[model samples]
Target: MSALETVRIREAGATLAAEAARFSGYGWMRGTSGNLSLVLDRDPLVLAVTASGLDKSELTDTDIVLIDGDGVSIDGDDPRPPSAEAGLHAHIAARTGAGAVFHVHAFDAVIAGHRWPGGIELRDMEMLKGIGHSAHDETVWIPVIENDQDMTVEADHFDRVYVPATAEVPEVPVLIVANHGMYAWGADAAEARRHLEIAEWLVRFTVATR
Candidate 1:
């Protein structure tokens, strides 16, 4: 990558760190159970991924490790290990061409996923537009897949369930890991944030109304 591109990626990572801190403040990332990542390059396939076991409330650019397509840390002398869920992030980035991915352990997502093992169908809400729905009446079906402790197994389950976006299928960029949390992605960090926030809100709304 060019020097300019590298600089831009660093700046973007810093911005994402701030967003992580905000999410932490909201208790979405409590217990250090959440992670976020951004794509830095496609040709060589570099990513800025969060390190494992770090407090998001104190997240900084240093907390974001640069990794390759295979989730190998490329950032020199960065002692921290990449998040264990880094494989999932790489899979999503490769399959969906998403520029950013956010996985959070929020109460609403966990509760909703448990309540509806099938999925959550959010419709007739203005927040749907935030997740790429053009009309409020359009349904946003977010899948809730069973969770697994083994990363390889979790990834295989994800691969088996995830359907690539197409003209015929409405993009389902957000999913819940049953009894776990939510994974939301978009073209960039900002868009991913919108999707995550909207999905969380809708999940909470659904649970509250029920």
Candidate 2:
């Protein structure tokens, strides 16, 4: 595989598309439901996200759309458009220096959403180190907020409550939208995808044990 072939895994180009494809294979993003994004820069962050509602499996570089600090597109004209949750990605990248954010609808995660009243607590899991902190002695709180139709409102809620609450601990790099899906991020796309995968595994393990 050449550099291009390796970079474009399966049918992906942008890091977001690659992660989306991986998550789709894991059955987290099905039926064109979930979305993903990655930041281009950090000193002055900019984003290139998948065009909204496109099937994650068929994603290619052509579908990746760039957005400014305000979450407005600053790239080519692909008629489809960015995901409805683009603002949420922009918010996290701007505020937290996150290079990538992966959102998905995993089966076990959805089940765990109903199981936990507030948020799911991931404690004593060795995989917790993949995120950021090395906390084998504490509970990593992954907040689960109710999903809503208003993307901007939900984004604000995430910023105001969810972001602050989770940022209190570095290891907790995930946020669950009750009954909807999950979001995970990191300094870059690879790490972010790892975070998503780890969170998915932890949730699945918790559900199976219970």
Candidate 3:
């Protein structure tokens, strides 16, 4: 890689570390239970993903690995392997054209998924606007897929339920894995984080009230 590309990767790593720390503080990414990725290049789909088995809150900017669209590590110098969920991240980005993907084991997400295995529908709430839905008189369904230990199988399940955004409907940038966690994404890191937070809040509210 060229010097500029190397610099970009390092920058993305720092961003990922900061995001991880923030989510960890929220108690959504406790232990090494979550992962985040940033798309570095779109054509061939290069990503900077958090390294596996590291404490999210304690991660440094260097605690990241480069991976391809297939989630295969490209940075040979980095001894760490990508997060086990990196392939799911890659699949989400590839399918949705998202620039950043975040997976967190939020308690509410797990509860919501288990309670509504088919999906969770949120409507008539002002917070719904936060996830690109109308604040009132509109509904959004957060997709949920069964969990699998094999990443490839998980990716396949994701593909089966994936929905393309349309002019009439905004894309729901979040997904929940039954009894597992949530995945959220956006065109960039900030938006991805926003989507995750808003989705979690919506789910929490749903779980609390009903």
Candidate 4:
């Protein structure tokens, strides 16, 4: 890779590390249970994924690995392997055109998924605006898919439930994996974090109410 590309990868790693730390502080990514990825290239689909088995709160800029569309490590120099969920991150990016994907094992996400196996529906809430919905009279459905250990199988399940945005329906940027956690994505790192936070908040509210 050229010097510029190398610099970009390093920058992406730092961004992921900081984001991971933020989530870890909330106990959502405790004990290396979550992963984050940033899309570096779109055509061939290259990503900078957080390295496997590292404490999210302690990661440095070097604690990341480059992976391809198939989650195969492309950075030979980096001894660390990509996170086990890297393939799922790649799949989400490919399907949604998202530039960043974040997975977190938030407790409320698990509870909400378990309570609403079909999906979680929230309407007419001011918080709904955070996920890009109208604050009034707009109903948002957060789909929940069954959790699977195999990344490929999980990706397939996500595909089955994903609905693209239309004039009548806005795009849902987050989804919960039943008995697992949640995945949120956006056009970039900051937006992805926002989506994840908002989704968690919504789920927490739902769980508390019902």
Clashes of each: 0, 0, 0, 0
Task: Put down candidate 2 lDDT per residue, 60-95, tens digits, no spaces.
Answer: 776777677766776555455778888788887776
lDDT of all predictions: 0.83, 0.75, 0.93, 0.93
Model 3 regions more than 4 Å off: none
Q: Give model 3's TM-score versus the native structure.
A: 0.97
Candidate 1: how large is its RMSD?
A: 2.1
Candidate 1's TM-score: 0.90
RMSD of each: 2.1, 4.5, 0.9, 1.0
Give the per-residue lDDT of model 3 (tens digit) for 23-116: 9999999998899999998989989999999999988878889899989998777788899988999989999999999999999999999999
Number of clashes in model 1? 0
Q: What is the clash count of model 2?
A: 0
- Tens-place lDDT digits, model 1, residues 14-45: 97788799789889998577999999888888
Q: Which stretches of candidate 1 lie over 4 Å from their true place?
A: 1-6, 134-137
TM-score of 4: 0.97
TM-score for each of the candidates: 0.90, 0.84, 0.97, 0.97
**Rank by lDDT (best first):** 4, 3, 1, 2
